[model samples]
Target: MFARRRPCRRPSPDLRCRPSGRATFAAFAVAVTLLPSLAQAQCGGSFSGFVRGLKDEALAAGYGAATVNSFFNGAAQDPKVLKADRAQGVFQKPFVEFSRRLISNDRIQRGARKSQELNKVFHRIETTYGIDRGVLLAFWAFETDYGAFQGDFNTRNALLTLAHDCRRPDLFRPQVFSALELYARGGFDPARTTGAWAGEIGMVQMLPGDILENGVDADGDGKVSLKTSAPDALMSAAKMLSHLGWQPNQPWLQEVTIPADLDLEETGLLHRKSVADWQADGVRAKSGSFALRKGPAALILPQGHKGPAFIAYPNFDVYFEWNQSFTYVLTAAYFATRLEGASVYDAGRPDAGLSGGEMKQLQKKLQARGHDVGKVDGILGAKTRLAVQKEQARLGLPADAWPTPALLKRL
Candidate 1:
């Protein structure tokens, strides 16, 4: 999730979540005017045509005419959703800055208070799903500040707009149908339900498909009220993470100290080695015990060799399934550790990172050199990092993937 302005926190991702925080209605209305032309172009002509097809599909899928009609009744193209989709480049911030911005003393204290207030709920989630409260709490804090603002976008419009958009129709289109199914089940309201711009519902910002699959009525309310029920939100998140293959009672991330001469090639998400092997290579835990010392782990130099390093375990991989942004995942995972009483990371003196403009230039250079860094969006994404590592190695620099001003100047 990316940062937001005022009252709200941030918007969460969809199945592989993207950021969609709150925006002002004045801004939302302005964005709407800029949408219709692009909407027509992208949705294959007038939005009505797309709605007609959706209605037909719903009817064919066996929903009654009234239900289908009502679901699509007032659905309109929301340009802001598309805007949020494209604006997710904010996740480009390096781990240290991003984490520092998000992990405030207020959030950490609030997370602790929430944990205590919901002790029974947390205990139930842990016992039932084998997931720790910190994971849920961290997400809860990030995705709407523990339910303070679960987005103000109209859920129906947000889903339809994304479904009609060209960029990721496949992901959002199916979610529309899933919302239909939830609506049919007496759970969703076409006009009333609202959350993240990406159509994620509730405090934890789950996609419609996830809600359909993992929703839990933890408070014995007979209905999974994620918006109003803390127990429901936390438990549903735990169940979803469990479904996402979260290893129970396992550590996801741990800050570590690496010897100066450590083989930089062995450090990265792709290169997994046993913890013992890493220890032999002089990667020692910064604090606390390793829950699974023999587990397979990757040495992640998030800001290259000079910045904070972490040993990411298998559970860390599961964060990608929740949100694909490497920086967001690392920050969230690290925050989870912080909520569980881990010490703050020791941020080493990493070289100054590239400006957004410089980063896009670097990405362009990497692409010209035949390395695929996805979009030249100024974000130091995974593919870009890999390309950076290759270039650094070729240039006789440390193969740590962190991009810096010096590297940019050299290139």
Candidate 2:
């Protein structure tokens, strides 16, 4: 089993790890050119070349040869897809800023309206899937801003590029095959299979494999169309969440106040703990209420000791499992609040986020300082923050895992 790391205690500083310098870019360019040859040797031929392999596997898995071949015949490597994949601005901004951009007023308002408009559909989905309608609406908003910007990138092309790229072959190769399976099932025409640069499809931008596994035709049109059908998309998303272990009628997260002397190391909800157990340790609702009556929740310090604290439930982790980004999950929860007619987060605290270039530089510096900051990828995950904390402790700085201009100067 893959070991899950703890969530970030605080919002990541602007200067987390990023991809190495231009040399790395040049190397990537070379790798992309050689990817097809490498893939042919490993799994044989290009994506189309893998057809026979897929056929054998599909037959073993109870699929017919005609079904497998029909799907693979339409699969081809798309150069524009590869170009977009290479052009991604990974680790381009701080998590806080990224979250802010995604959880905008337009998204909130649209989500609220969409929630109201789709009340019956939402209720039916909730009843059938055990996932809340507001949460589903929030996901819809967060992913594509209520379909205002469902990407036009051809998903088959993107998946082919990634599968050929080899850096993450283990992850993407299966997805490529799954997309073929989806095509064979007539979920969507291969010509119209478009989505994000990474091949996530529809309003919620689900991966092809995910769609194949969890998609539902809620409208009963005899088709599962995530692009044109809001009901189908929303129900499919709720089903995905339910499969991911979403608990019905449970809070995803709650703003909370932690005691001044609480141990940061002991802050996570790895094991189930009662709300009363947390209140006994002086944790209180952010609403300033002492009444500690609620369901099980795990404490999350998104910005360590200084930033906002939250009592995140298992449902919150369900959101994280969707994207594996702390900020992404937070934005989903915040958007859900707006769908439920709650106020937006008050920006009383002032912390300017870092730009894309600054984040890249910081990640390089952290890696140079001997921290196991993975890949210098601009996104700050738990590994990157732990590395930052180690360096901060060494420099006698606050081990809060927040990056600052002063820290950059020190580097």
Candidate 3:
């Protein structure tokens, strides 16, 4: 009776519609509806916690907390960063042919104009870095399409993602930490930190560790910004070249005619030989000039037996240190030549680009016959070609060592 009287006397709008238990149940339903968002937030928070642990390690490495927080506070890991770390494809054409696609007429013209415009700074850089202006300009053109497409992905996020992904952890993890240190020092703003999917930043696409070590204030404004300042980026790249042992006054690579009927197997790993020695073997410069008299050079046949070859020098190896891909380094050298008004390559090579599946099958067949084809990775390198040659010799084929669908069928 007391309960009924109380309810009748004190029923308010807030309590009239539902009992306390019902109200509590409705609130629980709303919370259930928002559970997915809450879980997502929790996951993000866990990632942030990992970042904080990294930040503490960075501070122990002598970075300021403020700097660490600025870089990592809102940094989300990007999954696509691993795409850049995978090994690249094998091209059917030699580097000379590859370069023709990179150093187009339009690119050459723009490079020439840019070179002329930046002549003063170029001269200064050349004097200071002992690197040729044309070489640097060529790199600028090749790396970012003359700064037209330097990528728009967040650099920190990409680095962090790659570092966490164990495929290349040892290489990328330190880089991620180093980038954090750089950001902590006010070296660059987080918002301004953007680059390729693999964390290569700016016009030159240099990694963060490179920025920390080789970055220079070429503009004399007391900061290194690869994003906007051409001089800084170019100078930094030139400095990196110098560090990588770019010899002065040495030709990077030169086109050479391979002697007919020479045993390709006898060439054996492309050892460095004197120009005189190469001349004795019937390898001659395309221009009929033996200008590279000083250093040793190696013969590189990018497309096996039926493509243009080059006598690449020590400096050519240095280009490989910048980017490991033979195609990339060759393109860089070719672009440099175009910027200097040199003729494009005329490698009379044939197209033989195998699809990924085809290459895998070819590798498998070679392995089945017991040749060290090295992991069936769908890339045709020296090892793969050697395996093919061994298989061809076994089958009493022509032994040219080139892979084809016909060869696959026989296998």
- lDDT (Cα atoms) of all candidates against the true structure: 0.80, 0.63, 0.65
| Model 1 Cα shift for residue 44 (angstroms) | 3.9
TM-score of each: 0.89, 0.76, 0.78
377-399, model 1: which lDDT tens digit per residue?
A: 89887799899999999998899
Tell me the deviation in Å of residue 258 in model 2: 4.4
Two-way lDDT contest, 1 vs 3, winner: 1
Worst 10 residues of 1 by lDDT: 5-14
Report the number of the highest-TM-score candidate.
Answer: 1
Per-residue accuracy of model 3 over 301-369 as CA lDDT, tens digit each: 665557666677778877756764456666777667656655656566634645667878999888887
Worst 10 residues of 2 by lDDT: 8-17
Local accuracy of candidate 2 as per-residue lDDT tens digits, 206-311: 7776676677898999888888899888888887788777877667777777787665544554434678888888878766443235666777655565666677
On TM-score, the stronger of 1 and 3 is 1
lDDT of 3: 0.65
TM-score, predicted candidate 3 vs. hidden true structure: 0.78
Point out the higher-scoring one by TM-score: 2 or 3: 3
Better of 1 and 2 by lDDT: 1
* Models, CA RMSD each: 8.2, 10.2, 18.4
